[model samples]
Target: MNPVIHFEMPYEDRERMAAFYRSAFGWQTQMLGPEMGNYVLATTTETETGDRGPTQPGAINGGFYGKHPDWPAQHPSVVIGVDDIRAAMEKVSASGGQVLGEPMEIPGVGHYVSFMDPEGNRVSMLQPLPRG
Candidate 1:
């Protein structure tokens, strides 16, 4: 089965959100600049290689993105890791889910895309670059 590898949530104030998570949960937050869309990466647990991901199995990392008025369904969502993005997109479409748009490559991360499930929940999928 495909596994959830990450999560995402929209935030109106990136600094406030990061501070809250850091203070309450001891999560490490790294704020990316505008070139990267001002995303905030949250490391919830010890990672294998600094920013690679959680070392503990089943424990995932996540990020917070600035909420945009034009974005649809900006809610908390999990990202599923898939081997082949195109195949996954087709599968999602065949299963009655709507793939929002073409997949986009995240520099040093991987190919990512969002979709709306049948239940109207927005989720994402990622095809990660092979770990070195």
Candidate 2:
């Protein structure tokens, strides 16, 4: 699954958030998507080089955030890549999780939803569409 797990923090300041991360870890965010509304992905290569593999070759991992997320703080969501959102959601329900919002589109990205796990962990999931 392409799970987009997020770290929740106060302050909707992406720039300051960027600076903090940049200083602490030497990483940066690259704005993505149309509107660029709250969409920022972080990248870095700090540790000793291991096997160095991208999920999809050139695909970079370890994203960061230094601003407000599109979703609310209580609804903090971490996405899991799945072949089927409907099926995955169904599994979420069967597993005692409650779906919170309507499945929404990220325009060019894909679909997403917020849900609470059986244990009441506020989390979210995303399914990014494949490149044409």
Candidate 3:
């Protein structure tokens, strides 16, 4: 497992927002094109040892940055680490949930999908690299 996960915050200026985070938190980011869509991964690290310690890894999952030029800004949404998005979606639909976004790859990372549960709290899921 990737341990910690991240959330997506809708920004008016994605580039500027990303820069702000990088500067403020010392977060390393990398642009993931095509396969991962137009999103960047935020990397956390351990300052003392400079290793993927209990706190951070060489390149953990970075939050995705984007703009909501249309919808009104709402509560921040966190993406949870899921085992299987498709199977989970099936379970969601079987109950009373609805799938919002279909399964999509996160560049060379993994896959993710968003959906609403029976209670209606906004949530997302990401399937990280399979265990070797």
The candidate scoring highest on lDDT is: 1
Please provide, for model 3 over 1-132, each residue's C-alpha lDDT reduced to its tens digit, 9 standing for 90 to 100: 433366665555567867888999888766666554466666655433432222644334445656545533334677777787788788778988787867877554579777777776666778777644
10 residues in a row with least lDDT, candidate 1: 48-57
User: Relative to the true structure, how large is the alpha-carbon lDDT of every model?
Assistant: 0.95, 0.60, 0.64
lDDT of 3: 0.64
Per-model TM-score on C-alpha atoms? 0.97, 0.66, 0.67
| Regions of candidate 1 where Cα sits further than 4 Å from its true position | none
- Candidate 3 has a TM-score of 0.67
Error of 3 at 132 (Å): 3.7
- Residues 1-132, model 2: lDDT tens digits: 354433333336666776887799777566555464455666554333442324354344444333434644443345566667887888999988898778888676678776888777767666667755
Worst lDDT run of 10 residues, candidate 3, spans 45-54
- Model 2 has an lDDT value of 0.60
Worst 10 residues of 2 by lDDT: 46-55
